[model samples]
Target: MFKVIFRVTTEVRNTAGLREIKRAGFIPFMAKREGEEEVYEALYKSNDLEELREAITEAAYFLNKVNRKGGNNFATIYKVNDNYVGKGLGGLLGASLGLKLGGIPGLFIGAIGGLLLGEILDVELNETFVGVYSWPISIEQ
Candidate 1:
């Protein structure tokens, strides 16, 4: 599991511009405010950085194309990681729930599921990156 933070300017905020990003198989995990800019984090499950890079390239290309064709869009990306506490706490909660519901088998299944969820949450909590491109264009209506 790898994390990628796609930072774009809030000057052009619209979900329609994200079509290309979603088409590229990136999952929008969270969004935050950084001073006067808006930042968005996305998740990607790739075997390595090379694979993630290819998808990111394609996504950037798509965004550029959209912008050239009268769309107000610009974005930059970065790689990030998940924290430890999220993984541990998620597993603990899952195990507790499983134990209350069933026996050992339930505990195992619950722990695994919880751990995965927790790892994802950790990524959302620990994303920090500087945006490369910032566009202040307006959407063509």
Candidate 2:
């Protein structure tokens, strides 16, 4: 199995895109909003490299279709070597935890720690957000 992460941006109402495509992607784990746009992050897998790419393009198609302004959607094949996206996620989590644990100083420490761990995930485990980062979602009760 090819370990990977899939990501895309969709209309908030259309976040169900990934779930619909492969029926295998994890529910989005992160949501980031920029001004008026939102993106979602998820980690999952496929049979192999080829299968993974197919799922990603399918996700890209879904995301693009629902975009309000004909925006471009994207996906990844299997994984990226650097996996900066994972690092970013780690950084965000670290920062939040740091704030809670030790305030501003801890924030820096947490971010660095998270980033290093993310790097380890990318290298040792070959697990990282294999797709885009320029996108978010939540489950509603």
lDDT of each: 0.64, 0.53
Query: Please, what are the lDDT tens digits per residue for candidate 1 over residues 34-133?
Result: 6534455677766476676677667666655554222123445454564689989999999999988988988999999999899887876776653343
Off by over 4 Å in 2: 1-27, 68-73, 76-141
Task: Give the TM-score (vs. native) of candidate 2.
Answer: 0.38
Question: What TM-score against the true fold does each predicted structure earn?
Answer: 0.51, 0.38
lDDT of 1 at 101: 93
Residue 33 in model 1: lDDT: 57
Q: Give the lowest summed-lDDT range of ten residues in model 2.
A: 132-141
Which sections of candidate 1 miss by over 4 Å? 33-37, 68-91, 94-117, 121-141
Predicted candidate 2 versus true structure: per-residue lDDT over 30-81, tens digit per residue: 5555544554455444445656555544555555555522233333334535
Question: Using lDDT as the measure, which candidate wins?
Answer: 1
Our tally of clashes for model 1 stands at 0
